[model samples]
Target chain A: MANGELKLLGTWCSQYVIRIRMMFELKGLSYDYIEENFANKSELLLKHNPVHKKVPVLIHRDRAICESLVILQYIDENWSGTGPPVLPANPYDRAMARFWAVYIDDKLPRQLIDTLKAATEEAKAEKIADIHAVLELLEGAFNKCSAGKVFFGGESVGYLDVTLGSYLAWIKAEERIVGAKLLDETKVPLLAEWEKSFLAADCAKKFLPSVERVEEYVRELLVTKWKVTSA
Target chain B: MANGELKLLGTWCSQYVIRIRMMFELKGLSYDYIEENFANKSELLLKHNPVHKKVPVLIHRDRAICESLVILQYIDENWSGTGPPVLPANPYDRAMARFWAVYIDDKLPRQLIDTLKAATEEAKAEKIADIHAVLELLEGAFNKCSAGKVFFGGESVGYLDVTLGSYLAWIKAEERIVGAKLLDETKVPLLAEWEKSFLAADCAKKFLPSVERVEEYVRELLVTKWKVTSA
Candidate 1:
C-alpha cells in the first residue's frame, strides 16, 4: 500500500518538528516540508490541528496527525517494512524506549525554557542544577537501555534516540546562552558521548539545526514572545 | 510465552491504577494487586520506579513499567493475541486515538486540580470553564472517533476509551464537590452518552471506583495534601 502525498507542516527551529524530520530520514521516507510561520499559521496547519494549532502536523493521504510523538509512531507503524524499525521489536524494549522518550519530553524542554528565561543568576543556577540532576538520571537510563551498545536502540537510531536527540541543538544553544555545560562530560559522560555520536549519525546530522541557528532563534523568541531581554 | 509473576503496586483511589485494573479485566489477565501506602512509601515501589516514584507500576517477570499511558501500551503489545486490541489497528486511527488520549492527559487533570485548589469562586468558575471547553472538544473528538458508534473504540474499549474513561469517576466527584455539571448532557450529548456506556461495560464495571468513594478521597486530598478547607 502506498503512503500517498505525505506532507509535513512545521517551523525550522522546532525540536519537535526536527524529531519528525529525523524519523523520515531514518525511515528513508520523503515528505513535503511545509515551513509554517509562527506569527501567521497556515490554514492547513490550523485546519489539521485545531486543538493545539501547533506545528509538526503530518498530513498523509489527506488525514493530518498532530503531535510529534504521535506522528512518529504513525510513521513507524505505517512504514513497518521500509527501513530499520524506529521502536524496538520486543514489547518490553519498546515500552522502555517509550518510557525514556516520555521522560525526555516531560523534563528537558521545560527545564531548558526555564534556564533561558531565568531572571537572576541564582535562579539560573537553580534551574541548571535541576537539569544536571535530570541528565544524570538519563545517563543511567542510557547505560541500561544501550547495554554497551552505540545508541538507545542498541545499534540504530530508535525512538528514544530521535526523541532526546532532537533536543541536542537546543541544549547546546542553552549552554551557549547561559554559560553552563548541560551535558557535562565529567558528570554525565555517557550522555556527553551519546551527544557526539547522535550528532554525527547520518540520519540526524542534516535534520538537526546548528547550535548557532538555534541560539539566534532563542534570542528572538525571548525578545518577541517571552519578553525576556536580560538574556 | 507465559507472562510470569504479574503484580500491580497502586493506591485504591488512583484513577491511573483503575486504568491498569480495567485493562487487566479487559484482557482477562489476573495479577496480585498490592496497595501502596502513600505516606509510608514501599521500598519495592521506590526500587522499581526510582525516577518518578509514582504508582500504577506493572511488574511482570520482575520487571517494572511505570507511567499509566506507557503501561497500557505495554499491556496491549505484550498480550496482543490474548484480548481485543486496545489501540486501533489502522495507523491513522491509532494516531488519532493516541492524539486524543494525550490531549485528555495533558488538559483534563491539570484543570481538575486547579478547580479543586481554586481559592476564590471566580477562580474556580474560570477553571471549570476551561474544563468545559476541553470537554466540548472531546465531545467533537468522540463524534469523529466513534463515528456514530457507542464508544471511542467503536465496538470495543480502546486506548482512548481507557485513557479518558479512567477519569469518569473523578469527573463525577468534581461535579459533586464543585456543584457544577462538568459533563452537561445538554452541552456534550455524545460524551454524556459515551460515559454511560463506558461505566456499564463489563471490563470497566468492577474496576471503576464509585463516585462517592472518589468524592471522599478527593475531599481528603484537598484537606491533607492541598490544604483546602472550603472545598
Candidate 2:
C-alpha cells in the first residue's frame, strides 16, 4: 500500500481529469479529489506536476503522475487485480488499444487546434480540410476497432474508449466554434453510432460533459477567441 | 508467436519511428522495414494507415496499426513474452516511465515546432514564451524525477529514456531555429545531464538522426515555414 492518502488534483472541466476519475471509479479505488482553479495555479498542483503545471495530477501517497493517459495505464496496472481488465491480457490487443488512445491524443488535437484557430478564409479552409482528414482517419480506426462489435473492446468499453470518449466530447464544440464539422453520419458513420453508444454507456454518460454546455462553450469560443489567438 | 510477418512503414527522420525501431530491437523481433516518402506516400502505406497517412505504421500480416508510440506499446505487448519488458514490473515505476514518454511526446513538440516555424516577431515572441514556459516546467520535473538518482529509473535507461532520447535529437536543431536557448547547463542542468545520459545509452545513439542534418533542416524550415506553422 502507498504510504499516504491518494489525492487527485484537477479542474472539473478537464476531460483528462474526468478520465482518471472514471478509471478510479471503475477500479474501485478510494482517493481524495482536490479541485484546482486552473485560472489560479495551486502550490500543490505545481509541485506535483512541474512539467505540465496542469492536471489531473494523481498523488499516490508521495508520488505524483501528470499525464492522463499514463495515469490510466498506471491505475489499470495497479488496481486491475480483478474485474474487467482495462488492457488486453494479450499483447497485440493492448498495443492496438494504446495505439488508438495515442492516435486520438496526438493526431486529433492538431486538427482541433487548427479548427480553433480558423479566422481568415484561407485558415478556415485549411482547418476544414484538416478536420475532414482526421474524420476519415477516425472513421477507419473506429470501424476497424468496432469490427462486428460494440466498443474498442469487442464487447464493451476499455481504456481506449475512455480516452476517445473524452476527446469526442470536445470535437463538436470545437467544430461549432471553428465553423466546421467533423463527424456526420454519412461522413464518419462509425463515429456517429460510436458516439451514440458511448453516450448511452453509463460510464461515458456520467463522465462526459453535458452536450448542451459543450455546444454553448464551443460556440462562444468560435464567436470570440478563435481568430485572435494569434498565428 | 504471431501468425504473420511484421512490416514497419516509417520515415527516416521521424523520432517516433526511431522509438518504435528501438522497441523492435529491444524485443528482438525481426520486421520488414519500408521507408515512406511523405510527399509521395506509397499505396501500401496509404492502404495500411488510411487514417493518418503518416509513417510509423506497423503491419502484422496485413493488419496495420499506425502511430509510433502506440506501435511501441503494441510491440512490447506482442513480443514481450521472452524478452526484457518495455513496461516496468512495478506499476508506479511504469507510471513514471509513461509520464516521461508522454511529456516528451505531447508537450515537447509544441516548443520544438514553434522553433521550426519561420515566423515574424509576434509569432516568434509567442513561440518563445511557450518554449520558456515548457522549459521552466521541465526543469522542475527533472528535479522531481532526479531527487534520488541520475536516471529516471535509478541508473538504467527505461521508457523515459526512449522517448526523451528520441526527442533530444531534434532539440539542437530547434535551438538553431529559435536563435535562443532553452536547455542549458545553467538553466536546466539536471535535464542537460539527463540528455547526455540518455544519448549515451546502448542502441540509442545509433538510432537518432545526425544533429547537423537536423539543424540544417530546422534552419531551412525557419526560413520558409515557421511563421505560418507556429502562427
Candidate 3:
C-alpha cells in the first residue's frame, strides 16, 4: 500500500499461504505472488525468512514478516482506513477473536499433523479422539460467535473466519486420507454450516484449491513420504 | 483499570505467570494473585481454561483469557490508555514485534526443551547448536531494534521485552542445570544487557524469582521429575 514493492512467497498446498492470499484479496491489494516449491525451497524464501525458512512470508517495503497470523494482523493494520477491518474494534472482542484465531493456527493444526502420523489402529483412534475434542471446542466457539450471523465477523468474513476457513479444503482432504468422517453434520452442525459459507465466500473461492486437488496432494504425501496407505 | 474486578491465576515458578504479573505491575493495576498448586490443579483453572488447563489465566469481570501472550495482549488492549503501550504505534513494527514474541514463546522454548532431554554429549551439542542459531538471530533483532535505546519499545519496557524478558530467570536456571553457558555474553551482548535491564526493572524485580530460588526449583525438577542430574 505504501512505497516499496509487495510480494508473497507461498505455495498452493499450504493453508497458511491461503490465509495471506485471502487477506490480500479481501483488501483488494495487488502483489507479485511467488509460488515456492515445497520440496526444494527458493533461496529468496529462505533469505527473507532465514529463521523458519518457510513459505507464506509477506514482503512489503523491503521488510519481511512471517507467521500467517502475524501477517494477517500486519495486513489489517497497514490497511486500517481502507477496507473492512479483519479484527474487531472492541478491545475484548478483538481479544476473543485473536484467541480463537490462535487456536486455529497453533493448536488445531498440530493435532491434525499427529493424526496423519498415527501408525496403528489404536494410535489412530487416540489421535482421532484428540482431534474431535479440539474440533468440538471450536464448534462451540463458532456457534457462540456466529450466532444469527453469516460469519465469525458477523455479517462479513473476518479474522476468526479466515483463520479457520483456510483449513476447510485441507480438512476435507484429511477426511479422505484418513478414511474417516471427522466433521459430522449432526454433531457439529454450526461448524459444518460455517465451513460451507466460508468456502462459498468470494475471497476464499478465489484462492482456495479444489478439495479434489488437496486430497490428491495429501494422498501423494501420505503414500510416498509418510509411507501410509490411503485408507 | 476499568469498572470490573481483575484477578490473575498463577504460580510462583512459571515464567508465563511472571509475564502477567509484570504487566499488572507495570500498569499499576490491583488484582488478586491466586497461586495454583502445580501437583493438584484447581477446579477454577480447569473450568476457565478447559482446553489447556494451564496457568497464567487472566480473569476480568468473570471472563477468562488463557494463553500468556493472549492474556498480555488483552491487558494492553483493555488498559490501553492507562499505561505506556506494549505494542508499537506503527503497523509494520507491531508485526515485527508479534513475530519475535511468537518466536520466543513458541519456537525457542521447545528447542531448549529438546536440549534438556539430550541423553548424550553429541546430542546435547547438536541441540545446543540449534538453540544458539536461534539466539544469534534474536540477538541480531534485539540489536537492530534497541540501537542506543533502553528497551525494545525504545524508551520503555514493552511487549517484546516482556515476551523475551519473562524467560530471563529460566535461562539462568537452565544454564545452571545444563552446566553450559546458554547466553554467551560475548555473542548476544545486547540481549545480555537487555536481560540485566529487564531483571532490574521495577516490575520484573517485584515478580522475578531470585536466581538461587529458580536454580533450586530447576534442580528439584530435574532430579525428581526428569531424572536429569545437575552438572
Candidate 4:
C-alpha cells in the first residue's frame, strides 16, 4: 500500500471531520487527509467500512474506524502513549464524557436531521426545541463543574471538549438556518463561552475548516435537503 | 447511609436496570437496589444526578453515575477490572462494538418509545414497522456475525450485548404494552436468536426482571402516558 500513517477519510466542511482533525492537531500528531465526495464514495472507503458505508472514516494502518465519536476515542486510545489523553484520567469523569456524548447523540441527531427536513414553522420549532432541551441538560452539567472553566471537568479540556467541538460549527449554523440562536451569551453563557474557548484554541483554529466552508456546506445541505423534501 | 457499597436507583422493570444488573452479575458485585419513583423522583436521585435526573443511576460510595450506558462502562472499568474488557481489545473491533451501540441508540429509541406509547391499531402498526426497520439492521449485522457464531462480534456476549441488554426487557414489555410481537423469530430470525443467546446467558438471566414484572410496568407506563396524550 501507500505510506502507512494516520489518514482521515471524511468530507470537507463536515463537523465530524473537523472533530478528527482537531483531535490530531491537539495531540500534535501528523496525518494525511483524504476528502471523499460522499455522492461518489470511493471503493476504499466502501470496502474499509462495509457496515455503515458512511463518511468520516478514519483509516489507521489497515484498520478503518467509522463513526465520529468512535473515531475520536480510537484516536485517543491509539495515541495515548503520547501527549494529553482525550479522555480524563479519572474513570467517573471519563464516563461522564461518554455520557454526554451519548446524550447529544441520542437526543439531538433526529432533531438535527429533521431540522433540515422541517418546512413549517411549527415543525422547525419542534426541532429547535428538541436541540434546546438536550443543550439545556449539557448546560446544567457544565454549570455544576464550576464557573469559568476551560473544560467540562473543571480546568482542562478533555473528552467532553473534543466531543462537543464537532458540533459547535453546526450550532453556529443553526442560528442562521432556524433564525434563532440557541447558544447566545445571555441565555447559555457558560456553553457560549465553552464554544469560544474551543474554537479559540490553537489546535482547533488551525485544523477546523474555514467559516466560509462551513457556511457553504450547511447552506448546500439545508437547501438540498429541502428540495428533496418539497419534491 | 447504611451500607457503603453500591446502590442502584431504577424502576422495577427498567431495561437500564437490567443492563447494570447484567454487568454486576457478570462481575459478581453486590449492591443495594433503590427503585426510584420516576414520576415523583426522590430528592437523592435528583441531587445525585442534577443534569438528566434519569435512571438507572448507580451510586457508588455515594457518588452518582447517571445514564445507563455510562454506568455500564464505569462498572466494567472499575469492578470488572480484571476480566476481558467489555469493549473489544482491537481498535477496529471496538469501533464495531460501539457502532452497533450507537446505531441501536440512534435509530431505535424513539420508535421503541412510540411503540410503548401506541394507542390504537393505526398507531401500533406504524410504530411496529418503525421497530422492524431497526430489527432488520440488527438482523443483517447479526446474520453476518452469526454465519460463524453468536453476538455481533461472534462468540462473546460483550459490550454491545450489554449495551443492548437493556432493550431485551423493554422489547418484551413492548409486546405486552402495544399488543404486538416485534422480536419474533419469523420476521427477524437473527435478532430473535441473538435475544435467545442473551437471555440464556447467566449474566443476562440474573439481571432480567421477571417477564411478568416488566409486562406490568409497561402496562402502567402506557396507561399513564396514554391518559396524557388523549387528554
Q: How well is candidate 3 docked (DockQ)?
A: 0.79
What level of docking quality does candidate 3 show?
Answer: medium
Span of 10 residues, lowest total lDDT, candidate 4 chain A: A222-231
- TM-scores of the candidates in the order shown: 0.96, 0.77, 0.95, 0.79
Compared with the true structure, the alpha-carbon lDDT of candidate 2 equals 0.73
Q: Once superposed on the true structure, which residue ranges of model 3 sit more than 4 Å away at CA?
A: A1-4, B1-4
1 against 3, candidate with superior lDDT? 1
- Provide interface RMSD per model, one decimal: 0.6, 1.5, 1.0, 1.4
Q: Weakest 10 consecutive residues, lDDT, candidate 2 chain A? A: A222-231
- Chain A of candidate 1 scores what in TM-score? 0.96
Off by over 4 Å in 1: A1-4, B1-4
Cα lDDT of model 1 by residue, B53-163, tens digit: 989899999999999988999999999999788888988889899889888989998999999999999999999999999999999999999989998999888888888
lDDT string, candidate 4, B102-140, tens digits: 778777768887766667668878989988877887787
Per-residue lDDT tens digits of candidate 4, residues A57-118? 88878677788888888878877887678777677777877878777766665777677677
Q: Give the Å error, residue B122, model 2.
A: 12
Best-first order by lDDT: 1, 3, 4, 2
* Top of the candidates by DockQ: 1
Candidate that scores best on lDDT: 1
Stronger candidate by lDDT (2 vs 4) = 4
lDDT string, candidate 2, B1-231, tens digits: 354478888876788888887776666677788888877999998898766688888889788877766776677666668567776668887777677666667677776775456357777767767766666666665575556567654455555556666776687766665667767667677777887877776657767888888877766655575434432
Please rank every candidate by TM-score, starting with the best: 1, 3, 4, 2
Clashing pairs in 1: none
